[model samples]
Target: MFILPAALAFYRALRVYPSPVELMMIYQKTVPEPIFKIVIELTNLDVKDRVEGYYNKFPPQSLGVKVETRMVGDISKKALVLTKDVQVGEVIYKEFPIVGALDSDLQPKGLYCTQCLREVEPSMSIKSPESPVYEAVYCSQACQSLAKPQHHNLLFTLERPLPPQIPLDEITPEKLEARRKAHTQFADYLKNQAYGHSAPLLVARFIARQVASEMNKLIPGSSGIPSSQDYAGADDEEYLLADHIERLRYVEITPPQEELKLITAVLDTVLPGLDSLVTEERYSTLLGKMAYNAFGVYYDGARDDKPAPTARPEDIERTRTPMGTSRQIGSAVYTVSSYLAHSCDPNARPSFNAGNSQLHLIANRDLKAGEELTVAYVDVAQRQDESVEECRRRRRMELARGWKFACPCERCEREGTTVGSEDEENIGDESRVEKNMQRFESNEGPL
Candidate 1:
């Protein structure tokens, strides 16, 4: 890590330096430490420990931490220790960053993952099959392991990302607005603060980053983000089915509901709005028709009584099913229905992030032709035991703001999965089957 001050200066000035591994090419450096260990500590030690702790007290200290090249980032309390032998200027594994706590309703609305700090990839999300219980979300397997304990290893509901690949849509204003409004409702429910859900906030952070990226491109002269910042993520554990069904209650999709204001305004500047935007059918058929497309909207539709859906894997792939949907940036390819088709058996999903943007599109299934699309904007594993009525109520209050009713799907009726029951007042009326079955909060649980 010495010599070549001129090169170092050039690298800093350029603001576009060599790759991590490429940096190693600058020089080959090594250190020999016999019977030594690289220690990584994530303790609550304060500055006092640094200036006057045992290390300082003993001068060189007995630990014998041999001198070598330090890494890019400084060692924080929660730092990773690389063996002295491990190659430098290379990616290292450390526990993921923890953002916030779960929401009152047991959703993963508070937790945040660093990988998702700036960019929230919808494709990174996974749904749980166990039941409804939201937990912390992460960009990789490492993230999940680091966040499990905080969620109490509870098995509510689930949405686990698989190795299988699926398509996704670029984030848009319509998607943002719809997500915002829904998010506002979800937050409102948290007003009671029954149990915190980090899933919502985490998912929002995950999706919002993508939304912001797209907006900047569409608005050219703008921050690329809308008024609403937060998003309504998956539930931590409950499913207020009736509330969601009623929440998705239709009143002739207005500018407010469709988020036509920001959406249309941006579209007017460059392309057309929904009118010019391909229909759900055409969008599904033609993946590359427009420079960008909304493809779908987020409404309170569900299989167990809420207006929302299960957001299965197949549903999401329909909209982004095309082979390249995952990798494209502008006017990429995906299933049109994967974009707009609502869910009861949702195969797709969305997530929120912290930074600026809101909402994202992720696949839930393999998706077949004509398969209705859906994204699970709520948490799963945690809410497994939540009744349909409770899910509906929660959705209406948290995401829909009492604007609609619960989903009346057969699951909600026979199994009492959702909320839209004759006895809206009583949520306990429904039995808990999926609730008891749900297992892990992270993706591994589903697998």
Candidate 2:
């Protein structure tokens, strides 16, 4: 188990808070001391056991790959290293997402399974008429059953939020109305305002999943709602979902205040005090992580008729996809696949061969054991009409604009000399991890 440093204990006793500069994006004004104190307490509780030897716990042999730390200059990066030699087109592993969300445009249309994002024939799909605010349809009974217990009931339905073993206050008519109103408001907010962004819904689903996991522990002989357990190891018993999420890298994001309020309101209404699980700082970090790590789920060759975005270029949401976000039907975040770094010429590519959110890692070239697996985050293939130099610039610009990172992969390095100065000014890496995560990884104290 990871241990907290002595310095962090001292800081906790002193009640030291993060500086304004560190919180500017998340908070417009000074956070009330009480809320800030809650943030500090939550951080102290979680950071103690998140990072040290965390990657070692994943079952590498079963997954056919291991996560190893590599140094790119002074920065420590995690990479997926193959455990066995494989040829092109070989399947390395298959993973289910911890949480998945359909694209905003498709969510209300009932053309896809909200649980798996699988395309559904209207006549054959199962619809949830009980959902007051969201129109959730499933392709199968299994999808509907898994989704309701995991998150759908808590967020979208009036069903009991906790297991029978757990006691609850009487559900008065007033309480029921309040819960319905909160769910309706949050669902309407997502439908009317979320647009291209799937991060908000993904974050909500993740939080609900965590709550469900904890609640399930109250009953005997229950493993809780299955949450991407395809390769979980013995250490999973000791680690919570929060432990897995806190270690991943995140880009900074400033979500709207109303979004948080709507989500927290729903949680608080369902189970009192559950809203405390997500503070402003925590919510922002969760959103950033989801946005950074989520993969676009597409099938076949991907679609070409996605609607053009009216949002400004910088405001448009982008998921990690070689096919580009426009072509994807939905987005999902996988625990293991999150470690697969980007390459202009990748050794492995993520494929949704099952026509759902499940990810299959396919080898692009013959490889030896210990080779680092990589995938193209943005479309990196040279277009038929574009020159090599032009292709390099286009991919680099997408990386910079979408992920805030300049490519330093072997392919980019070889072509760097040919790219001229005209595009150099526009490309740069501005990506960053959360401050607490950096401190934890570096064996320092909490902020």
Candidate 3:
């Protein structure tokens, strides 16, 4: 390991003239380990550990970039800021993760590789005869193998009869009961949180898998996943779910009983003679968490030869199932990407790569060290005139209704003056609203 004196001097030289060569020189002189391995360790450590390690190794002034938590008004905002200037179009980070949800209604069956969420060539897809859900779709043998664990637990076909269809005008008691029963069974199976029937269930499974993976690392020669009987007693198993779900943004209002009842009915229907596998409270929490955190999965470009759909263009917006494209094929929660805070004017942008099931975060402009990276939760570029008040109104509506936080961003502070310090207001300027009818557009910034 490098000593403090060596590290400090190396850091100072790099600060004065930062380059790949300088970095390599410092590493060669001080680090006995492979430089690439050290770089990977630095990049992949837990955010807190990474920040602390960097600060300890070199003065904060020496590192040109850092990810830090800072107080913004009463809230703590986690931002990825530059310690040095970075050029526009530079990729800040990249992640490849399986999507939690894909709209089967929009995408043709077998369009995506199950494991990586990458698009599959129809001719290259593998088929499963035994499974109903995944019976005829997979991008490759490798993806199928990679997805086997999650699939085995969550993707079994139920040996049950489908309820007979009844015409809408001739509704009957028997039909209603059958429909209810079918839905209940679906809910029960869904509660297992296996392959992400819903975003929340998928998120739950993601959390569980991560916990199990970590546990395996700590305990050798044994599966890290504890049996249900041992789950409660296991260390931090429950907290993993609690912590991740809590990160979702939601309004502080209580869910209605009707919704709760609907969820309870489904749990009851799953496995008739057995006890319900999911509790109503847990189900409710999953629903709440999903409401705020799920990301739309879409083909990055047009999916076919058809003319663009009537909806807004993809280049300027995040549209699910955009006009000519396959649109949103599904939804996902990229755990790390969720940390980015919303900004009307942002310094970073997220672009999906359908080919590899990856999310790429690109610099929107030349960013100075210490400038926080941000992305607009809603379309910031869609608004033509850039009326400050219109932006405030739209942001307030989204925050109050969905995000459950009062934004104190510079733009919000500027336009929210007459609307009261804390309360959000509706934007009544129809003409201004009409100018920016699209949602989630990213064209306005310096990308």
Best by lDDT: 2
Which parts of model 1 have CA positions greater than 4 angstroms off? 1-345, 351-360, 380-393, 396-405, 417-447
The TM-score ranking, best first, is 2, 3, 1
Best by TM-score: 2
Task: Output the worst ten-in-a-row residue range by lDDT, candidate 2.
Answer: 1-10
Stretches off by above 4 angstroms in model 2 are 1-53, 193-195, 227-236, 418-447
Clashes per model (N, Cα, C within 3 A) = 146, 0, 15
TM-score of each: 0.22, 0.84, 0.55
Residue by residue across 189-212, what tens digits does model 3's lDDT show?
A: 444432223543353345334322
lDDT of 2 by residue, 265-371 (tens): 99999987667557799789889889889999999888887878888867777888999888998999887888899999999999999999989999999999999
Greater-TM-score candidate between 2 and 3: 2
Better of 1 and 2 by lDDT: 2
Which wins on lDDT, candidate 1 or candidate 3? 3
